[model samples]
Target: MRRVLKITLVSVAGAALALNTAACGGKKSSSGDSGGGDGKKSIKVGLAFDIGGRGDQSFNDSAAAGLDKVKKDLNVTTEEISAKPDEPDADKESRLRLLAGKGYKAIIGVGFAYTNAVVKVAKDFPDTKFLVVDADQCTVSGSNVEGACFSEEQGSYLVGAAAALKSKTGTIGFIGGVNTPLIQKFEAGYVAGAKAAKPGIKVLPAKYLTQPPNFDGFKNPALGNEAAKGQLDAGADVIYHAAGGAGIGVIKTVGGAGKWAIGVDSDQYNQPAVSSVKDHILTSMVKRVDTSVFDFVKAVADGSFQAGVKKYDLSNDGVSYATTGGFVDDVKAKLDQYKADIVSGKIKVPTKPGA
Candidate 1:
């Protein structure tokens, strides 16, 4: 038998109230107490989502799936909170504090933006374990903190190859949510993979929706739409976006134009928000955030938690390309061969653009 967990969607204001309620003893959990009849300890887990949160149908949703799996497979109680667009670091700190103060034994922060906040808060709540996705624990060390990161470039490479193989115009495009090193990795791999598949491929200059400190790029569909239109008008027949929620606009615009659009993080073809344009989705560069999150929580529950970074890559099935619409079926063999070359060290994907 399993317990059902109710996850609430609360605004930043509502989160403050939830924090206040927790301070007044709303819910409580003891450290590693075996409560369930099955001898498994029932723990309280808190998830701090990235911008666009659970319904973005992309990155945050992938993390939410892991939390959902934790709820189904383990004896645990859960709470989730999301970040606002362009929110300050203080807000992230506060969210982590809120979860720690609520007595959550394990807290997971869903994006790289939480790096500083996770480092700061984990210090105050040494008893509570913290995991920040897309962050490197080695760089931001904390005794109680761990990181879940992925080789996004490796996955992006596969989709870029797919786009190159399918493109009839010999031109493709890459759109990033923010102009950051992380997003650049996606561009680098896409370009490298496209060029690898076809030596004469023409890739347009990368476009970014926003720069640092204005992360709204991740949640702004309008920006994505504008960028996609520009690329399409410039003769790009296939477009790939690493733009989180904003990718919805990319899909819509590309689909409306009957061109191919590749997705990131989650399989957009099956994403309900983009169901109407599923046919236009070429494939997605699937990064397994869900597996990493579940593994982190499970480690804490089993008292095997380690404070360090864990990297998920092609060899571990942590990153790969999706084939949801069967759009890439004809090119699957070539893509797999590329994947094998990458895994076998015969090919090394670039992590920076123009590298």
Candidate 2:
């Protein structure tokens, strides 16, 4: 049984931490500063969060979960920086520089927006290891920058299969937060998976909350609701969204319309913010950002830190479809078979739709 994804479940415990205390800029604070008797020096890891920050209950929060695990299990100290919506690239650069400037051994940028900043900053701080999540665009060429990218399409494929399998109307919908290569990965995988499950299944045209240069799409639930309503009105009984916080609206609309919704990044079924509509959430395309984040920090702490691109995929347990709601139980065996085939390379999940 060769593992496809590197699945390591880390438990996150504690209040959410962020470095956005100041109105105009980022802030940094220490957690678990208590002394350790082992006499091994503690390492400082800094996280620069994406738009929704620590409490978005999605992507950024998943990264925070990894940080919390390090704080509890490894006894490491950490600091977090939250990103403001539509902030300039310079601000992102400054945040990354700040973390590296503060003597932190490893500084992590939580989203693809940090791609440019990580590439530019890592050149100056050669001693500091930089990790970027979701930004494979960041060049690791001759620099100390490592990207922790996930096979989002592979995970989306599973959920798409679930959506097709579970849809009673023979139609499904997908909503993306922003129009980018990354989000497109989610769209492509989902559509492919859906069709694979049920040939000739009608997939509605994918909708975007916003395009690039306007990332409010990731944070705006109003937009998500509107997009979802459009889908439901078009006869889509099941919708899957990779819209971050905005996806909350999708879930709400699905529940209100008596349809089904699939979540992203983190498990929406476990989130209190979406509790009211939990029953409507069929499952989540769980992208384990925490595992990647934790692995980087842990490697540095263990004196085995390396700089390069590390990918998580179905083959490595880096991505999968969640089953917390148990709505997919009937299709679990079939989904598991698909998972096995993908892991065995018999099925190659497409990163681009129709590819």
**Full-model lDDT, candidate 1:** 0.86
RMSD of 2: 6.4
* TM-scores for every predicted model: 0.90, 0.93
Report, for all candidates in order, the number of backbone clashes.
0, 10
lDDT score of residue 296 within candidate 1: 91
Poorest 10 consecutive residues of model 2 by lDDT? 1-10
TM-score of 1: 0.90
Best by lDDT: 1
Report, for every candidate in turn, its global Cα lDDT versus the true structure. Answer: 0.86, 0.84
Model 1 Cα lDDT, one tens digit per residue, 230-286: 999999999999999999999999989999999999988999878888999999999
What's model 2's TM-score? 0.93
Residue 268, candidate 2: Cα error in Å is 0.6
